[model samples]
Target: MALFDRYLAGQLLVYFGFFSLVLVAVYWVNRAISLFDSLIAGGSSVITFLEFTALALPNVIYAVLPVSALVATLYGINRLSSDSEMVVAQTTGLSPWRLARPVLAFGLVVALMVSVLGHVLVPLSRTALAERGAELSRDVTARFLKEGEFLHPGRGVTVYVREITPQGELLGLFLQDRRNAAMRTSYTAERAILVRVDGTTRLVMFDGMAQTLQVEDRSLVTTTFQDFAYDLAGLAGGDDGARRRDPREMPTPALLRADAETQAVTRKDVAKLRSEGNVRFSEALFALGLPLLALGFLMLGGYSRFGLWRQILGAVVAAILLKMLANVTETAARDDAALWWTVYIPAILTLALGFALVWRDTRGPHLIRPRGDGAPA
Candidate 1:
């Protein structure tokens, strides 16, 4: 019994590992192609491209694990059944439950690993990738700003350069601020240099003229200075450091903390946060449920006399429906707690059906004995 269990486990694990690699490779190629345009736009180096691709692996792995598990299980079981190995084992008094034990154990282990990755590692990787991408964008922008063009640094601010020296200095700099409509402020400089100050980049102008236009009284005040600095608040606002932390980018513990903090917020904000938190929790739990689902699917595949292609088709359809159901339940859970009931119901149904099938297959053939020389009992 122990040897048979080891054989079954080894067969399933080998196939699972192969399919997982294939899925990961396909996803990586697709992502790299999709990111090609962005790479060009960002002027990314080879190292940057490689780093981005590596950072994206967690999301790909999370998406592919369940499907690979299902496919590998189905294939492995079908192969055993087709070769009559399962039949021989059954004749030797190996019950369906006993045969299923190793596969279920394998599934549980995979599920736990996936759960940890989905709940912990995925969020961290996503946050790091986003931050790095933002930094790259900022660096690219600072290097690529052209002369003789009006640039909007960020909201409510505009900068115009009449010319730029070959050495990359601004020859004629003009900046406007309409942040306060009631008091428009404009600065002009004969020469300016962009510099970083206190973790923020600013434009320092030499021999510049300043204008203050007051809309309340239609008044204009002008002043001239030998040296002046314009620290555009808009630039500061554009810093990626100030960006909102998306719930998906937060670990489970941090998400819980955030939910607690937002309890005193407005009702709308509370609903939004609760919705996000519940969905995250559901997805994390779903990773654990996948192996159970895979086991059920494997039983169906193994017992069906339909051709291998048809069984494969059925498994594919089943996987699609399961995913669709999960997504629908997740969407609902975000808006209402009542929807969580829908999430676990499918898992329960699948488990029950799998157990019933396995029981009937293993016991039905032995329950009734030939009676009275093939006559009625």
Candidate 2:
């Protein structure tokens, strides 16, 4: 039995790894293209792009674990059945429940992995990702240093640079600020550098001429200087620090214990926080029950020489429906925390169905003993 369990468990894990890696790669490529476009368009460095994608992995892994677990179970069992290995084991008095133990254990392992990702790693990564995004969006040096291109960091603000030196010097810098609408200002500089002052970014231009035009008075004033300071902080929303974390980025404990003040700070009501907390647990349980559900369906009838394709299709459909129900329940829970109990419906229902299948298999069909070697009982 131990050997039997080991064989099945090993097969499941191998299949799970293969499916998970492939699925993650597909998802990663999809996200990477979008992230790459955004980061490159914003003039961010390659290192920053890598960092953002790395931080996004936990969430992706969390999304795919349950589906991977189900596929692994189905593929592993179907292969074993097709090869007659499962039939051999059954002939040795191994009941369906006994054979399913290994699968259940495999599901538990997947559930643990998902729980960690959902409750801890994902939140931390999300927090870091958001902070990094805010930091990048505020980097005026990156925004303004593109050579020979007109860059618009904000509405009514246009910046141009003729050349960027290896020493981080900007040459032939041109900036036009018409954001005030009542007044227009233009600055042309021979050279410029970005300097930080009191947590604000300022472009210190050398040998620059500033021209101002008054809209109402229709008057123009021009000034030439050896050094001038133009505040660049306004280009980045004037915020020097991280933005407030979203409710999904809050740790489970913090979210669960959040008070009215915390809610105000996070801008998430108690219902939202409670729903997130419930979602974490429900997701884990859903991962755990998926294998049970799949196996129970596969075990519906004894092995057929051709295949159990029908049972496999039935299992897939059932899993999809269960997932849909779970999503709907989660949505309802988010609207009203009192509906939180509903989030567990998928797990509970699937587990019950699995158990019922096992019981019916255990009982089998009761056959009456032949009476007096006749057809009549």
Candidate 3:
């Protein structure tokens, strides 16, 4: 019995490793294709792209583990049956429950891993990735100033360049500021370079023309200079360097703390925050339930002798329905506290059904149905 359990576990481990690798690769490729444009737009480098993708792996593993477990179990059981191994074991007095024990253990292991990753690793990664994205967006925006295009960095400042080099050196630069209600200023330069000083950026124009429009008399006065500088303090907000933190990016502990702190906050803001927090918690718990669901499906697979493909199809459908049910329950749970009842109902149903099927199968046809005439006795 020990040897049989070890063999079953080994088979499941091997199948799970292979399936996880394949699924991760497929998911990575799909994400890369979908995010290529967004990454480029955000001015993310190869290193940034790799880091972002790596951070997403925890979520992917959580999503894919249950399905992989189901597939592997179905395949493993079908292989045993096709090779007559299951028949031999059955004849040797091995019950269906005994054969399923190892698979259930494997499913439990997967569930633990998913729970840890979903509750801990995923939140950390989400926070770090969001901060990185903000940094990349800032870098991209700073580098996007193009010649012959009016660049409005912020406020009422408009800058235009007749020509610019790859290094961002400007020629024939034009600038306009309409930030003041009483005054408007325009400057033209033969050459300019955008320079950063003391955490603020300024355009240093050389041999420029400057004009001031007086709003009082609608009069314009012009001047030329050998050198000039435009104060760009207002061009961008100083807090642009600050990172935005969404609740989803917060760790579970931090989110819990936040919820506690805001418990008395019953305004719309507090409700929104509470909803987000609950959603994250629910998602983490749902991920943990998936492996148990897979175990239940595996038990179901053991009873069907048609083939691996049929079992796989059934498991897939079951997993999809479980997820859909979870989503519906999660949405309801967010709106009404009483709706939390729906969250664990599917998991309970799955366990009950799986165990019932196993019990009926072990009891044989006579106990499960009428002995001969298909009528209840």
Candidate 4:
């Protein structure tokens, strides 16, 4: 029994690894294209792009593990059945439940890996990635300054620099601010400097003139000054202190023990945080249910020369339905904390279905009514 279990586990792991690698690569590449474009356009280095993509991998891995477990289990079971290994084991007095032990073990292994990613790695990666993005957006000197070209850093704001010195100086600077509908301002400075003050960026223009146009009255005002300051806090969507933290970036422990203060800065409310915390555990638990579900689907077919192709298709459909149910439950849970238990509905249904199938198989072949007038005379 131990040897057979080892063999089954070995087969499942091989398929699981293969499917996970392929899925992650496909997902990563699709995501990396967008990241590469955004980072490069923002004047970030290739190393920064690589780091951002790497940080995104944990979330992708977490998303793929349950599906990978389902595919690997289905493949392993179909291989054994096609090769008649399952039939030999069944005839030798091995029950359906006994055959499923190895599959259950495989499921548990996948569950552990997903748990680590969901509870730890994913949150850390997302937080780091967000911080990096915010930093890139705030890097005005590198991201916004280009000699002899007009740059629009944010909506309704355009800047043009005649030259950028190696000493980090901006010369022949032109700025236009139209963010305030009532007041339009323009500035032309011989030189300008970027400074950070009180966690916000300010453009300090030296020896410049400020021309203000009042849109309501069509009045124009001009002022001459040696120094002028323009607030840039809104340019990058806000500074680190002003940026709200996404719920996905919060640690599991924080979510579980979240207070009103903590919820204030997140995108969602307290109920949403609680629901998200429970979802992490539910997702991990669902991983342990998939293999059992797939094994049950395979066991129902016995050993047919015509093949268990129908059962395989049914298994795929079952997995899809389970995923849809999970998504619906998650959304409902987010809206109502009382519905948080819905997070476990899919897992419970899967386990129950698997158990029922195994019990039916243990009772021997099922009898069916004859069709097409070949009824039992």
* Superposition error at 249 for model 4 (Å): 2.6
Which residues of candidate 1, in runs, are more than 4 Å off?
140-193, 197-199, 202-237, 256-306, 337-341, 363-377
Best by lDDT: 2
Model 3, residue 218: C-alpha shift (Å): 25
Which ranges in model 2 have alpha carbons more than 4 Å from their true place? Answer: 149-159, 165-169, 174-193, 204-231, 240-242, 363-377
Q: Weakest 10 consecutive residues, lDDT, candidate 3?
A: 263-272
Residue pairs of candidate 1 with colliding backbone atoms: none
lDDT, candidate 1, at 284: 43
Report the lDDT tens digits of candidate 1 across residue range 212-286. Answer: 999999899999999987764345445534656666676565444545544443233444455555555455455
Q: What is the C-alpha lDDT of each candidate?
A: 0.67, 0.85, 0.65, 0.84
The residue-level lDDT of candidate 2 at 145 comes to: 79
TM-score for candidate 3, residues paired by index: 0.69
TM-score of 4: 0.85
Question: Which residue runs does candidate 3 get wrong by more than 4 Å?
Answer: 140-168, 171-191, 195-244, 254-308, 365-377
Per residue, candidate 4 scores C-alpha lDDT tens digits across 1-377 of 88889999999999999999999999999999998876765556789889899889999999999999999999988998888888787888888888989988999999999989998999899989888877777877676567887777667888889998887678999999999999999999999888889978888999989999999999999999898888887886676465788888888878877687668879577678988998998888889988998988777733456777777888889889988999999999889878878988988888888878778777755422223444443
Tens digit of lDDT per residue, candidate 3, span 1-377?
A: 97998898788878977888888789878987767656544334567678888888877776677667666766776677778877787789988678768766776776676667666777688877776654554342353366677765545767777987887778888888899989999999999888877866667889989999999999999999988877665554443444445655555555445455443332223334445555554544444344444444444433334544554566568767877876776566557654555666555555555566566566653432223465466
State model 1's lDDT: 0.67
Error of 2 at 337 (Å): 2.4
